[model samples]
Target: MKKGRNELLAEEEKILAPYAVSSRNSGSRAYEEPEHPYRLPFQRDKDRIIHSHAFKRLEYKTQVFVYSEGDHFRNRLTHTLEVAGISKTISKVLGLNEDLSETIALAHDLGHSPFGHAGQEALAELMKDKGGFEHNKQSLRVVQKLERRYPDFPGLNLCEETLLGIMKHGGGYETTQLLEVRRTLGPSLEALVVDVSDEITYSAHDTEDGLESGLLKLEDVKQLSIWKRIESSLPNSEKKSDLHSHSISRSIGRVLLNLMVSDLVDTTHQTLSKHKIESRESIAKAYQNKIKLVHFSEEFQKEFTELKQYLFQNLYRHPEVSRMSERGKETIYLLFKHFETHPESIPESYRKREGEDGRMRIICDYIAGMTDRYAIEKLKREGILWFPY
Candidate 1:
């Protein structure tokens, strides 16, 4: 006997917290369709995100290091997977809907440009007079209008809840495009969990990648209070070799993950108790009142901020990273300017579609969707690489 969607919904109602957004309670999509018989709405949304063209493109997208730099560094795809994994873990511990959390985590970065933040900055600067480029807004656009998957709908036509979660996760650029999702003040618990998980992942994994790439030295990290604490906790006999350095980074990641998750759960539970938030409606009211329920403790927040500042000063701003970023920015800028003058080279779907912002936005979409290799190839194809500007 097969357990159907109804059974799954029933199980979710029994297990999920009163404030969790269950599949059964999901809002309708723009173009309404019959619910799936075999799977919940969130589950179907998750599957849709996994199969989308944008998801596959993430493989060649940058996460600090471009694909040509090294195969070992984390691409957008791996980073998304890591965020999903951590989000699900935290969601499970907090009694939230794991499917919803995982779905949002997976789709959170779908709007990132080819060369990561550097590429995004370039695009944003180019379109500064226009609507401007924001990855979070672009993410919303990907699901809402860009993806042409269905006959009845232009985009994926995902559940409203799933769309909202993706838009609110990570607290990035906000969008007013969707009137339905516009009023939300804070994200749901599941989305909040994903956001924190995203923070945990990059703060730790980027450090690991930096160390592995020789851009960041082990001695430099030891000066940070958090790293010192994590390093000292290791066994005294552990020799300080490459393996030792790797272990220290991993330990720092693990310790920070555990510490943040624990504090978040505890703080959230306390807030929920203090406010007596027993239902979805009450949770919404809490958010409307500007109360952020999911959060690390005050002590941990300071430490995390300090760690981020240290990383920004040392790792992210290192000369090697900065140089690569500059190259990436220049690459995106040239590709965009080339396509602007040569619109025929742009693809049909992106070009033909009557977007809200017109040709410039359409061009922006085409460039934003490109992978690192694709962008580089496009630049080379136009013979733009030969110029020594």
Candidate 2:
């Protein structure tokens, strides 16, 4: 017998924890529609995100290294996949809703500007007076109003929970933001898992990328206590040679991921116990305090903070990475400026929204949707990124 959506919902009820967000209890979308025959709301949301054009653009989007840097390095798409994987792992172990967590993780970086953070910073500076260019907000915009796939709806028509996760991605949001999700109450446990997974995936993978690129060395990362702890967890024979950088980096990432996941699960369980939160209503009430229930222990937090800071200074700020960032920023500035002067170059779809949302925002939306290669090519095509001399 082929199980249907109702069967899956029943299974979740039996399997998931009291605190988990069940599909049966999922909030309505902005525009309601009949539910799918086979997929739950969050599961359908995950599939919608996976099929979106913006999600595909992530393949050409920068992660830490530029598209021109190398083929093996992590692109935005790869990073998102890793985040999704980690989020699912954490959520499953914590007895949370894996579908919602995976959806949030996959969609978290869908609106990241081309050239990674450098491009974001450039766009932010350009839009500072106009509005702002935070990727989290941009992500919400992408799903809510930018994407045009359905005839009945303008956007993906994702469930409210998925939207909440995308909006509250990076740890903070103003009360004025995403009022639909009721900001007075904090984000769900699934959203929190995605947030932490984003941090964990990037920190470990970026270190691996830096080491692989020769921008950072084994000795360099080993200075951080977190890295040392990870290194110490490995078997003695695995420490034979530094030439095995790739394997060593993978080991380092795995160890750190395990430590973080283990701690997060333990801490979350303890928090639930302490607060006596044994039901969905209790979890919702607990969220009113705006305290994060998913987090590392104090000792782990201190060590991870030190490790993150070390990566920022050593890996992210390496001369090679900085040089790429500078070039990327220049490209973003020039492109935004050119498009500003020649609004006619804007696509008809974007132009249609200009009257309603303003030209700058439409332009930002268009640029934010571009991949790294597309942005570079567009600039070069316009003769703005090069000179005949």
Give me the displacement of residue 78 in model 2, in angstroms: 0.4
The lDDT of each candidate is: 0.81, 0.84
Off by over 4 Å in 1: 169-185, 232-245, 354-356, 386-389
lDDT (10s digit) by residue, model 2, range 1-389: 99998898898888788888889877788897998898899988988889999999999999989888889999999999999999999889888999999999989998899989999999899999888889988888788888888999988999877887787634334455456455554678888889899998898888777777778887867777776677678767567856546877777767777888888789878887888877766766888766567888888899889989988898788888898898888888888889999998888999988889899988899899999888888877887755211
- Winning candidate number (TM-score): 2
C-alpha positional error of residue 384 in candidate 1 after TM-score superposition, expressed in Å: 2.1
Residue pairs of candidate 2 with colliding backbone atoms: none
Sum up the clashes in candidate 1: 0
